[model samples]
Target chain A: MYHDNYEEDDLAAEVELVTSAQYPQDADVDDGFDSEGVVSSQKQPIAVEIPDTIKNFITYFHRNVLENNIYELHTLYEVTFNKLTDRFYAKQPWPEAELISPLVDDDQVFLTLYRELYYRHIYARLSPSIQDRFHSYENYCDLFNYILNSDFPVNLELPNQWLWDIIDEFIYQFQSFCNCRNRIKNRSEEEIALLRDNPQIWSCYSVLNVLYSLIQKSRINEQLLVNKNGGDMLEAAGEYGSRPLYKMLGYFSIIGLLRVHCLLGDYTLALKMMDNIELNKKALFSRVIPCHVTTYYYVGFSYLMMRRYADAIRAFSTVLTFIQRTKQYHTRSYQFDQIAKKCDQMYALLAMCIALCPTRLDENIHNHLREKYGDQLAKMQKGEDSISVYEDLFQYACPKFISPNGPNFDDPASLSQVNEPYQHHAKIFLSDIHNQTMIPTLRSFLKLYTTMSIDKLAAFLEMDADELRTQLLMFKQRSRQQKWITGNLLEGDIVSTSDLDFCIKQDMIHIAESKVGRRYGDWFLRNITRFQDVIATLEHKN
Target chain B: MAQLAMNRPEVIQSLIDGVDRYNPDNISILEEYLATQCQNEEYDLMANLAALKLYQFNPHLTNDRVIINILAKALTAVPAPDFNLCLYLLTEPMIIDESIKQLTALHQLLEQSRYAKFWETYKSDSAYEQLVSEVRGFSRAIRSIVARVVSMTHQQIASSLLESYLDLSGDDFAAFVKEQNWELKGAIVQIPVNKDNEAKTVVIRENIKFEQLTKVIGYSNEM
Candidate 1:
């Protein structure tokens, strides 16, 4: 827990103290900043007076690495590295706090040291195996949180960077370590304890959480831009500082808000939240340059919730332009492709909603919907009698709108902006639509079968087709001699005196002769014929 | 085991329909009277009709296992019950087919073992043992019939069972077919023969094995 004693005024005082301590003669302090605003000790760069050997080593290390606080590692570098660098890193003769003043945030410096000390204690308690990965930012944060919350034994304060080192080690080796026999195959008590005690164990999943947050934020920012007033507000605010801040914060809030609304069955709130982005769109553009394209698609979705056909179509069409552009590149921004597909799906659903409307006004709307959603619109018109209401709905709802095997928006450029998992949700959404009267049973089955492979079908039925086929054959052979044919079953009973007659009468012969579904249907007919032959032979013998 | 006429499918169906007309206690006597009265009448008609009616409610209820279990419970209190009477009462189309094959197999086993009247007593232990010994291959055959029935449509199964039944009797089996009027069966296509030429016709006998039958069917008989 962080201490509450350091107020804003106290921070201002500390900053003034640091600035005054650093610049004694130049009292030309700006009116905007308080006297204690700057920390002076940290302002001093590492001195150049150190020996060439020491300076060279420090220079090589700096060149090889991204800039990070060095005081944490300075002591070790000084003691071991003096032979190489000739300059001492952290002499330890000076107070450690004073030595680290340059790197540490004044208010948080003591707290940071306390947390580091706690993590070291936790790390010391862990087994040697766990200790190996106890290096990195993530590991430090996890270990710090654990030690601070619990009573782990150890006496010294650990540097925050050292704590982070543990976490960094854990992350870099996480996947390979998990794959090892000691981690997965032979899950010893030590490994279990490591998992239970180590907070960094969950950090791997935290990356996905971060990604989701960024995506949500991106989406919200775009939505907020649509509204003229909200857009203006963001633009005006962004002029003074970072433009992406307000938009990112606004969008980050949408995922949780939308999720809660969805769970509460508050369709109105969900619709409004989705619609709000567009309502405040102008403000978003002035603030954030990289807004999520899915905002336009979801706005159309909100229109769908309201059952507003024309408006939904207009909103969705805007998203289509982005969809076309995003596909031109070989790889897309991770969420950009998702946004495009979502637009297409929303368009499809809008078509369905229009088709479902029971009004003469929807005639033009229905035609538009049918153009996209209907399988064979002209045929339905030609044979009006064949068109059932449910079939029309099936055509309109369009179960096959979302293609699972379609191209993905997976480019490093887009993904680099945010970190979120792109676990496609379209299939689940489509399945739900299928279940909720979007398509009739047979059509849905056909669509599902077309979308998924035969292998997947086996999983759905909970039986491998190859195994089932074998069982069926064995069953047929066993019943071959039985004279009694059940009235409940068709194949066992002879339909006609002649084999040709039976085949023709049952339409089996016609099916066999046809090239349609030649492989699957033909295979079925062959099996049926084999069984019939066995039945006929047994009857003759009897 | 004795068969309970009250539990007979026809009587039970009637009981279900005439819930207000017949007292639950009088069901046993009423069923017995009806069964006794209908003994001389055609069983196939009454049993098939009752089964077809019950089947409309839930097709799987007419399954062999389901029907057999019902019949077995009905016959629990009776001694030396007739299998034919039990079959008629239960009226499960699949069970009728299954029982016929089982009975024929039992007869074949008895005839082979030189004891033709083995199932005459029909006590629980004796009947179970007799059935077990006589038809060692019963379960497999029964299971296949059940599976075949499950696979086929109702009409296909009905026609197949009817055709198989005719074949079992073996005397101008087509007569039994003609008697049924082929209501349960689908359309049958007959190839027309020219009357101008005298052709030597070969009747494909029931004794032909599968391979031989296949070979025979394969040959185009010229007229």
Candidate 2:
């Protein structure tokens, strides 16, 4: 009953508020926080003065930043700040940064950080105008410049959560801008001119440069290598990577690139971005749970697009298990609901993958998938007209893919078509599954035979012998995948992923299904732990 | 694994490193790189995709031979998404072109592991030959891929089926089967068991180490 609402399709579609919502450890999970943005005509100008409560809150927030009191800042940023905004500026932008600058004593560094939140709040609640999006992009440049391009690494430190969010939000806004820029039919002439003239703004090249610059400045790759192999961290760190601020930003930037490349439909390049980092409980991305989720989400999606469904299933099941085991620890997190929604989406993705390439999933995860998508799974398996089912789950699970280039401003035809890069991707994926709609049914029939003539099988399936052979070939190809064995994420050896094996001997078809051997080790270990727990309970009672 | 140097031509590398990669003039340099990639087995997917991106924007700059060669190179990088990535960059009209359609027919057959049909359809069209004519050892490369896929799934297969899949016959087929080190016994070819096609039922048993038992031993001593 508690998680039933998370299965709603519209929950995570609004990406702004979740990314904008900061996570604090001891915060309450507020449910009625989804107030849709009420567009008002009078909200354009910086004509309003700062309210006293927000003013004091800004000053206090400024002092904590100055003092580097991350504990207080965490609470203030996640809970108090959002509560205050809901109470005061519900339908409008946070009072302009220039207007609030005096409250923080004209502190440039504090204001830069403040503007990060400021623009994010606008993006979360209000409609960001052309200028707002541009200014937000500028503010990101300023923030990264302060952290990266300083003559000396600035003596500034923020929470690692904030650092990760900065990169996350920067990319989110870039995605938002690209999507917005693609639909210029309603935009005024001035806006069109601005977009045409500022082609460099929010360009894929610029965004990639920023992430790459951070990676180089911090020497994160070298640091990661030193971390993997045996070496001195200080030496591998060089200068910028020594500090936590640069190290984490550079680290987060790698995960950031993993996400960015996925958005641009470069599946191999997406996984290639993870060459330096490993995805395990001990890896650095696991230091932050959201980063951990982000890493696996894109990795699994990329593998899915590449038709490596087994690898995709592995990635999803691992993270979904992690989330399930650690659900209690983060239930009180401000991002509790967001994390739950992501879990639900992953289950949907897992359902699609398992339907296509059936594998024995973890028992708990498999149960959850059946609970969430039982109807769709059955439909997908039966496969008469189930492309819509796959498309629905795909859209519900896949990232918001972005086009790398902007609209052709000179062409009126371009303005007519809004950016739907994900649809292009969906089309590619749907056609692939279309070619294999007969696999599940054919597999069911194939399991009943050790050897049979193609003509006999075709008679059963109501198809000609030639068509059946082609189908068998397709099954053979799809069952073999390039699985990751060891080393970098991209390099892998070809392996048989399917439990079912078949071959053609002239006219007869032979099928030999591999059975998963029953294991006593896991069962014994699980019961042993339960026995120990029961004994401990009895002893404590005595 | 990534530290291994991939062969990249300096002229093409310098151009791709900058905005000059999108120049219509640089298409020739990238085409040369694709030719080199086909002659040898070397591949640089990002470089080739960048070149395709240029042609997607400037349709006039596209060379049919170059597109076909890039797709051919992508075929070798199988199980990776390089081929589909190249397909995504082509213009709508180009994607549906007669030559492109026939070439993709070959791609689909191989991709679907319809090896017999792949060879059947490939030889059915002169355009398919003309398209992949630039790539040397093209049939050999395709056969190797076919062998790689078949070797993973079967310990022994009907030699006739294997020959059909490889598009080879008689002594040529025998030599190809020998190259895989498979034993040709009458109508069957026997492949040695490796990691994948062993098809053995494994009952996993836990192997405890001395280090793990040491702590338990200490507790026993205290008791």
Candidate 3:
């Protein structure tokens, strides 16, 4: 007989009983915590109990954070820290027994974040040097113990739910904190004595270990879409029916962290992480649709950054190939067509990233791009300017691709009627993504031109550099209108001419789609098609 | 030597029987084995060689000189079976459901297949004629009264399944009418509803307008 009447209250009590019993080494298997050296299975009950006072304090803290009221956050943190100290009284029954069970890393990490936040808030008045000296987890825990042994006035009963909620926030926040910390710590290191020294070799030893730790989770699959009984994903990571999106987010977050590590000259570690990403891509690509063009772009960019241009070319080419292979749904309206065109331009920009591969790359790399990409490569070679090839490709391809309305599966007159307005709208939208999104990307690429040894080529792109800058500046000035436009950032046009901005935007969009199963293909097709028409219109003006 | 001679016929028969005993599952396993075999460079080279020998008379089967030229040109990139498999799944007719879905799939496959050099032969005018003939074969089974009730396009004839047409026949014409009730034909592709009218008269034009054909058949609306 399957039990259908499982209550949250009962589960809370179950968690408490388990926690008091001194967790078996494998109790972590339930939390599905593997990467942080914690393993727990669903069979093991986690008895996590927080007294009532602590629960109210955390609830207030969350409410305040959501409402952006800092004063409440300050009050909650102050009260919780005081309660935390009192909970560790000298005569406490569990004080003699290690307060932390070895298997409970998830809980420990959660508590660590909580303590970190508390310490950061309380020590804000201290000097920066003083803050740094006492920032270690051991030191922070010691502070808590010191406060507990002392006469700390505390009246609090932590709620059963408080610990879980705090744990969730901690998991989310710590990733970002670790990423920033890695970058800052690495920047202080001195440059190597020799150029001939293999940075990759050095990086591998230093960075790879951390990168592996990040994406060590399982592959994301489609089961993630199911929302069975509101059991959270991290708690149910090993479950067969876990939603692919959450797992995917976890993977991406790790990748993003690894990317930061790479930027900090931890390339060896980043490369290791990328390998895991590549190996798991089949699962990722199959479940994911449309915008993996960005994934390819990043992998390629990472290679390009490390002077592994040949590999970079392969990645960029793959992005372009996948884009080209995709078929747009048939729609009569030009409006729908614009969306398709926008998609094409995005892909084209991705292609352009490889097309403009820095001349500093070895002879083998130059030949590889030329041989692999062919026409796109030829276009890159025809002009020394990075942005010019992009400009030409966008202007040439846009008219052919963009559309406004979703495709009408049937009807001649109806499809046409539906198309006209959408086409017009799409053109405007695409033109905006171009003026706003692509131009800034070109500007950033223009700056990279100086880094290349090829002066003549760099200068060529520089001639039109100001025009590109002006165009982006105009776009940047426009206010954000759509809900998707965070801080007025245009999605696709965010990358530079030499950089794969469209790919980035595409990946970002793919991420959005994967997270929420709302299909944007119809709108995408319309928008891209309209973009093409706008390009055609511009060509006529020119 | 004398003992081998006596058992040779039995040995050959045993080998034949062994192959004959292969079931569908056995064939599947063999197919996988063969695929992996053909993937080997030596096996591929031998295959080319075998075809080359056969091509001595039938150049159409395998022209060595042309094969060499093609191989030389294709040396840079190997054909990706995964990519081809994706294409197959995307265009395969085995997945067709409703009449509308079948028709859409048919048009899509035909149009895209026309662009590929590999698939260009399938898009010839004769291919269209064959499809038309197949449709005519299906239409022959319909009675005069029902034939009068329906108008068919050449593209439709090639695409519409015999079973689907049969489903519309006899007393089941009511179901057919219900299915068509959702189908919108000229000017717009949308359903039109009229209350309290069971046997609503539908005009079946013998000749579909050019624009309607283009909208539905020729160039993709999205393209």
Candidate 4:
């Protein structure tokens, strides 16, 4: 059956070619050639033999530009455009001029838009030196103007459904690009004024608004919510999977919603959206796209902001595990290498979380940390008093974790700008190690003894008695809920002030047994559970 | 007739009343029916409440994949604080009613690691006789956590102290210790220790000597 269909398709293509050759001028007027110049008269045999150069250009566009190799795409575009333009401008009459004119014009429009979008992606990944060469914001504004003024009618000869799908993806991506530009520029009043003054900007904005409204009107959000309740989650997952265009758009809508919310610092809403995506275990684990790593990364970041350390640890751990597994394959591609490097940031953030909450990293992750930040990690593990170790780890990790350049290089600002959110959180985590863990542990360690002279306790803690007393008094006042310590800090013996009286009076510290100590133990246990859940979720591919 | 309109408060009240009736089958049916109705009407809070009530009535239902689907939906439908009551249902199942003073006290006691006080208060609550099995299971989990915490510091504790902590009698305490494969020395019970062999032996000796010296010094200072 398939062979018969192939034969029929071949015959149709031959007949179409013969007809076009016999009446070339009539063919152009009658066919109303789409942007690609494919004759829409027959659906089965759309393939026509175009020049090899044109074929190469299309292939390069698909392989490099569509595949998100913006760096390579930029180089290829420069070479291809110059080569094609030289051939077109040569003094000799070009034999393929008729065939190539429409193709060139179409390429011009496509390349212009592609270049603008490509630079936006490039701005995210390139170093400052490379970024200075490209004015992405200006290019975007130029493209926006072109799109506003251009009367390029929707080609009736094209597959409208397919075209709309592409448009849908473009709109979604453009919205995200705008969002990043807005964030990266810090939404300056001057930029806002410029956008307001430019009427072309409004046209693009109106189109995005309409597109977004259409997406909302389509009830995709409500459907996603409803799917979580009782509907088949994989239903939408399957529909999106059927076509690349739908798949990209679907994945974008789901991921973009969460990312935008997280970027905006609406962590609660982001968390809620993440919860829905997570429940559709199929959607998360689906091979339609490897969204799990990106999804989990953002989810972890949001959880960190919300102070859900256990969940955050789980999320970051999943991202680390995914990167580790991918590393084992040793693909050595630039994209994979970028992802692996970003995982280093995950490691640093994971370390911060462990320090804050006292969770143990996996032996594998521990080994990885030792391998990367050997002496620093060892000092931290050995319970060194110096804050420099943590500071070094945080500084090393802050840039990578905050604006981790993924394979897509979706957000350009991360490359040049410090991730303010993670930077702020990293500081808090560092301060918390001192305030919440270190001080609390010291006070609880002292409380293990039934009673001890202030001088002796202070001597054991390596601080002056008066200073220790002042610190303890400050801690006591700060934590009004802690009833385990109550006494005059200035003159009396330091004592276990817990109401429950027992006779074991040795002044030995057992960190895991004390009230504050037990909290640390619980935190470790919670992290273990979180790690297990992350492993389970990642492995649950159906 | 007015109730048939299925307004927000009426729907929620109906769910509450259904749960009060103790008819699991009807409650299950109403849960699904009300969920659909609420979703259609965009009464998201009520939908989440109904889902919570369903999970509460048939705690075993959560084991079903479908119930997880409902839970995910419920969590997203409302803000975290609004769903606090439902979250409590999952975490503290035995204390179904927040208004119940005794159960509330039991929760606090367990949370605070006041095991001896908890057992005393639990025994006095004759009104919760029907909840003995559920409360006992919760108590065991809490006792295990306390036991782990206590054993972290002391190798040996007096039998009476262990009994107070575990709410067990002399023979029962000994049996519990035996069941856990721990050693007992007359009036004192030894908690099992699991550590790297070489390090464990070295640390134990050092700790014993240090503790003994500290005790002697403390006595001398007092004298």
Report how far residue B128 has shifted in candidate 4, in Å.
Answer: 46
Report the lDDT tens digits of candidate 1 across residue range A125-221. Answer: 2222333334324444543443333343222333232332333223323322322212222344464455446543423234224323433433444
Q: Please give the lDDT score for candidate 1.
A: 0.32
Steric collisions counted per model: 51, 0, 78, 1
* Model 2: CAPRI class: acceptable
lDDT tens digits, residues A504-528, model 2?
6556666778775566555655566
Worst 10 residues of 4 chain A by lDDT: A482-491
Query: B23-116, model 1: which lDDT tens digit per residue?
Result: 3344344334334323422122223323322432233344443333333322221111122223323222243365444543343222121111
Q: What is the interface RMSD of each candidate, in Å?
A: 25.2, 4.5, 28.7, 19.6
Off by over 4 Å in 1: A1-247, A259-266, A274-276, A280-291, A302-311, A325-336, A358-373, A376-542, B1-223
Per-model C-alpha RMSD: 29.5, 8.3, 27.9, 21.2
Residue A51 Cα positional deviation in candidate 1, in Å, after optimal superposition: 31
Q: Show where candidate 2 strays beyond 4 Å.
A: A1-49, A413-419, B1-31, B41-47, B50-65, B76-81, B89-99, B115-125, B146-223
Give all TM-scores, in the order shown: 0.24, 0.85, 0.23, 0.41
Better of 1 and 3 by lDDT: 1
**DockQ rank, highest first?**
2, 4, 1, 3
**CA lDDT, candidate 1, residue A110:** 42
Tens digits of per-residue lDDT for model 4, B102-124: 44454444433455776787687
Please name the candidate that would achieve the greatest TM-score relative to the true structure: 2
Off by over 4 Å in 3: A1-57, A61-111, A115-130, A133-261, A264-272, A276-298, A306-542, B1-223
